[model samples]
Target chain A: MNTSRHTRIRSIAVLIVAALILEVTTAVQYYSTRSSVASVIMEMAQRDVSTINRVAEVKKIAENALHHAVPEVERLFAQGDRDSLYRVLQQIVREHPELVGVDFACKVGDDGKRDGYFTFRNEETGGIQDTIIGFDYTERSWYREGLKHNGFWTEPYMSRYYVILMSTFAYPVRNDKGEVVAILGADVPMHELSAMTVQLYENMNHSLVPVIGLQLLGLLLLGFIMFRSIRSVRRLSEVSAEKDLINKELDIANDIQTAMLPDSSQIHEFAGEVSGTQNVKDCIDIAGSQVPAKQVGGDFYDFFVRDGKLFFNIGDVCGKGIPAALVMSMTQAVFRSVASKENSPARILQDMNVIASQGNSTGMFSTIFVGVLDLATGRLQYSSGGHDRPFVISGGALRQLEFKPGFPIGIMENATYWDFETEIAPGDMVMLYTDGLTEAMNGEKNLFGQQRIVDAINASGAFETPKQLLDTMSQAVAGFVCGAEQSDDLTMLAILYKGNSAADFPQK
Target chain B: MQITKTVENDNLTLSLEGRLDTLTAPQLEAEVNGKLDGVKTLIFDFQNLAYVSSAGLRILFMAQKIMNKQGKMIVRNANADIKDIFTVTGFSNILTLE
Candidate 1:
């Protein structure tokens, strides 16, 4: 009976050791598999974020193009300037590859005749085809719905011309009497976006197979160890939950970055209030836009009126995304705080450099252009921190505003900046932009270049307002890029000086 | 980006080919930050380099800061476009270009 008890005890010990070994091996496999799966998911998530950002960017560009073209289209059509309308339509489609076609469907006139045109990219021949509206476009949904709504995004439908799936952004053009005169439709192919979705699905499936196989094997090993398997599943859910939290935080950060910049409407309202109290009406017309390649970018612009001077600045940090965004925010804050007490742009830049250079161990730097415009005399005192020289448009001529390019901020503690003076007439405009404008790359890796910028500005004709000119320039760049992904933030600021005089200004 | 590193005595020469952009800047950053040890002189050959983005500039700036205490760094064979970028960013004043 003692020998029988000894054998039984040994058997129990052996079973315990085997169970321990199985548990340890299963735990190791689960840990490694979890990490690998996490990494795969992380990579896939990153790609999805980037692709979604690009898709959103393309949509925004298309919307802007439609919005900007409305006024021009209305004006041209009112004047019966079909030639200009044709040119505009061709330019829009030629520049933006995403725009498969554009049509200006006019409202049937009192004479039972419709004057409209359609310009489309012929996918088979790889050429743009322009023709007068042939069919009964009055029955088309784009025309009917566009006239009914302020702006509409049409459901995806197969394009009869290109024989591909296309969606359209339809906008109604109004006459001076507030009557809808025509419907403007911009078509975008759905194939590219659909292809991206398909690619993402394929990637998920490729990564999911191994993950599933590993999980199955783990479950088989842990079938006897119920508590541990449950714990592993719980940990995986926690990891995925953390990913969702991270995505939400990133979106919040993007929103905060956008909120930090001054809104154009706020600037205008502030101008109005100042003019109401101080007789500074028509002193300045300012507009600016910042489009980040990613959700958050390192480009910033700010303008505020204080003590009869318009303190405005635009800056670009020497990188992209989060790190650059941090520096951009700091630089903008420093500029705003310094400009509050400082009257000289050079001094503000100097103080900014000193502050930024301190504790800048990461070697991050920013190129900034600061301007303090005197509303009374139209005298502008500007300083540059290795930034692009702004352009002045006066008397229907374009010229670069000359300035000494100083070292970018945060490079050296002792870097000094100099203030240069320039005078803008009663009806002059100044344009400031970052390198993203000139260095925009197309699919062929060719830069949009400074020459293209000059050409676009020159071709944009005489500017009536800052917003119109800014829109024209933006459209030009968008067209030049042809829907390629931008690698940097595109920021632009335009200020039209109307002088302190309330007199009717000279036209450019 | 391809980084060909050659060390002779106390001097180090890294010849670069292709683009130094957002995607490739980290690779070069790792190479520079991880390997600079006991080197008195460092040289960057950019004969085959085609482009350099702001990220590339940041990496170069970091390297310059490190070499300021250890030794000197020189950039060689930069094309006109690269020179234009340096001139605009004021990096020409800070970096030794040849």
Candidate 2:
């Protein structure tokens, strides 16, 4: 059993161990991916710049040919020599299949009229293509764009004259004063541009192989680690489920044990019935409370008015938990049976001792205090069975009541007990409690002694009724043991007396 | 809580150490549940025992009650504080201590 427990612990801890290892490796993988991708992108970017510069140098030669010819063409046109200009245009358009055509338009008059020039190469006949009349060339996108910049690369567009998607490079020719006089450029078909883009992508793909490889490797590693983690997740869940089962059982046991105790509402009902009568309400008031250290404890208390007199008992069994709880229940029943038949506190205790010791097979015992109050005379008859001495508050004095102690019940057979009596004067309060009160401990393990209890009573001002005394004292004990586990069961009872009539507190 | 046992023929001695409260009481209970079936003398060593809540006392009671029928049970090496608890709760009357 112990080995399996250890194995379960190891299985649960394995998840943390594996996760920590994976975390470090994955962190390394993450940084490697970033640096590798960055370097690859840097290399590709440099290659693309080199490729563009080379293509621009080649294309510039052809545009430069048009530029060099511009001055000559201008001189010839001024001389009205259209033939030499045509020769220059024809030489430029001669052999390059991609260079569809070359054109040069110049305004000769202030009316902005342009002398349009030409070249001929049809698509069906695949040499340099033909160009038609330049109609208002200023309105042309290439002309307007080139006028702004010396070298302007036009976007691929369908030319009205060529009737095909084409790209253009237009270079402006400037006079001595730097004013644009003419535009000279060539047309390239879209298919060649598409081809260059495809080649660039192919080169990028080759350089990117390592980056993509690392990414895929990281993904596979993550998948494998995730699978292992998922398997360990079940082990952790199994451990949690076992813990949950234990916790649920504890809650259910606590609930069942609490249900076994009589609810205060039932006690309140009896207490209420006995009150409301002017004489009983004025002459007597009784309250009792109990709190177990565990889900179930061995402390118990009961109070009732019998034969025009009040009788009460509070006891603590030797130990705690289920066994002591069972004995506690038995003690209550035995005390109730014995108390009903007997009026004297000593006789009631003696009777309970005999009955409790009946099956004395289990060596269990309880310290108890029993009391009988004579309502007419305001006298309280009481007995202690190895319990803590009771306390009384009268004439503004708080002290433990003096009494002879006897052996606790269930310890020995035919044990004799003695009863003691004290007067419950008007405004006097009587308090009966178990040792769990005085023996309450704090986090430092220091006991809350009987002197503290006496001080608590004196600290709280006059008790108007028994319940007030009980509540204040309970609160004091609770405050004394704050944040400390209740090491024992605590039970307390208090009785505050008034004179035999409601006349004590005069009605207006 | 740690429980170490030494067995010799009809005698068995268990050395108990640490707190024997509600949480650890069941362990001692399990060790005593018929582990002494054929043993004539069962002994408890409490030299290192720090505390025993009432729940722990219940288990001890059960072990004593069981041994009452078939063998002898005794506890030894209890510190003064533990002895005081036993005396106050009446366990000293029934349990043999040394």
Candidate 3:
């Protein structure tokens, strides 16, 4: 897979695994918490059910006592004797420790005197006592409820008689005529509930806490690791993507910059079309080349004949790389525009300066040698814009044609430039170059200089075609600076003026 | 190229070292582009400058233009070889030098 797809899959895989792990943790926690809650609810409901069951148990014991000793209880109650009923309640409480108090409640006279006593487990005495004997228990909830139900169990509540969260299991004591005379009750408190659940929990859910706790710890550790890994993955991908975009843009810029230069085949085409006569391509043979140290360079050479004159310029824009490349194109366009209308080298340079300085915010300039060759006269007039001198080779001799020093274009608006002139005989050549050639550095930091350039031109047949001269010079410079990175944009333009003039070619 | 910058009052001083050619000219231009505001005087200390191309001169022209509208700009302490490039290019006309 490609890197982006691979990275997406990796990230998605990581997320899936983490999500699965998280899902396990969440499911474990959710189910465990749900089970715990269910257990709590069950425990609570079980307590309520057991509470009801215990009330029934107490009623059964009371019923059993009444069934066995009802005759004695009624007789004693009628005789105003309570020792037997007190012994029975004490026995029931001792057997069922959940019960804190038990009593026999009854009515005695026409005024309805509350007589039977409530027996409680006294803390100070550690014995049964009749603490509720004198209290009027008829108006209370337990007595009123006991009278109403007569024999059923009552809901658990705080019994004023027992002074605890208690319930009474009450049943009626009937005389021989089956007339209800008194009620028997047993009070049970819920203070022992906590002890009951502890036993119930050990029997039901023993290993749940530690297992769920360990899963929680694992979840946290895995979550942290996954989060960190994903963060780093995203950061790495972003950086690589940015780098790729920049490299891609540089490649495009390099292609565009290289395409912007003047091509040699164009000259042959221009020569044929402009002259409108056969075999006039020999009148002006021109060739040039540029190589940037970086992928994109600021060196450019442009030439287009206007009205039978070859107007050409070679330039090195300030700076390098993308910024320089942009400036280079702008300078090339400006030169073409100005030279089309104005053929004078000086006027073209001046007009270019005006255009270049208008919104020149980047503070870059082009050092240029703008030259125009008259195909009819074999005369060349050129202007300098802070550019180096060109060398002319004719009649087996070489000489540098120097021009007046001028400001490089884009430095100042309305800067004046002056044109210089020279004549090219048959077999004569002109070599124009940027500083990249002379200032080319070697491994030992020595410049190739003008001497090597002149020597290279002389070594090559100076009378050869323009392309030969350029190739020879470039090869010599590259040979001198072998294995050393070229540190600047190297540009050179070579031209061999030919075929004398229009008169020499005569009419076909 | 190495450039050291110092700002005193409204004057910004830039000290240039090594060759200010195609590769290093932007370094100088970017340094002073932001600091040109509210500065009445801009100074270029070329004491250690050995070589300058038209690229370097272009930066000088920009600074001079910006300073001309705000205050004044000048290049001083230029060595003989560095001065010769300025002299030959007639950069002296567009820029003020000492």
In the order shown, the candidates' DockQ scores are: 0.42, 0.13, 0.44
A385-413, model 3: which lDDT tens digit per residue? 88878898886789987778678888778
Supply candidate 2's per-residue lDDT for A430.
84
Query: Which window of 10 residues has the lowest lDDT sum in candidate 2 chain A?
Result: A499-508
Judge the docking of candidate 2 as incorrect, acceptable, medium or high.
Answer: incorrect
Per-residue lDDT tens digits for candidate 2, residues A1-508, read: 3544785677667657766766766676677667766766776687568657756765676567666777876666557677787777777777455477776766345887776565756667655544556577767777778778878878878877667677777877666566776676677665554576677678667756765776676677677767767766766577678877866775676575556444434434444433345445556667677777876778887766666577788888877777887788888888878887799999998988888878787667777889987765677898877667778898688767666676578866777788898888878888888767877888876777778988888898788877888889889988988979887888787877765664332221
Which segments of candidate 3 are over 4 A away from where they belong? A1-231, A238-246, A273-278, A459-463, A505-508, B5-12, B36-41
Once model 3 is optimally superposed onto the true structure by TM-score, how far is the C-alpha of residue A142 displaced, in angstroms? Answer: 77
lDDT of 2 by residue, B5-82 (tens): 999889999999986765688798899876778988999999999776555776787788788898999999998767
- State the DockQ, from 0 to 1, for candidate 2: 0.13
Score candidate 1 by lDDT: 0.83
Error of 3 at A489 (Å): 1.6
Candidate 2's displacement at residue A58, Å, is 5.5
Better of 2 and 3 by DockQ: 3
lDDT of 1 by residue, A117-230 (tens): 899888788798898888888877888799899998888888877777877888998888999988889987878867877887777677667667766776675575565546
Model 2 per-residue lDDT at A307:
64
Provide the TM-score for each candidate, comma-separated. 0.60, 0.56, 0.59
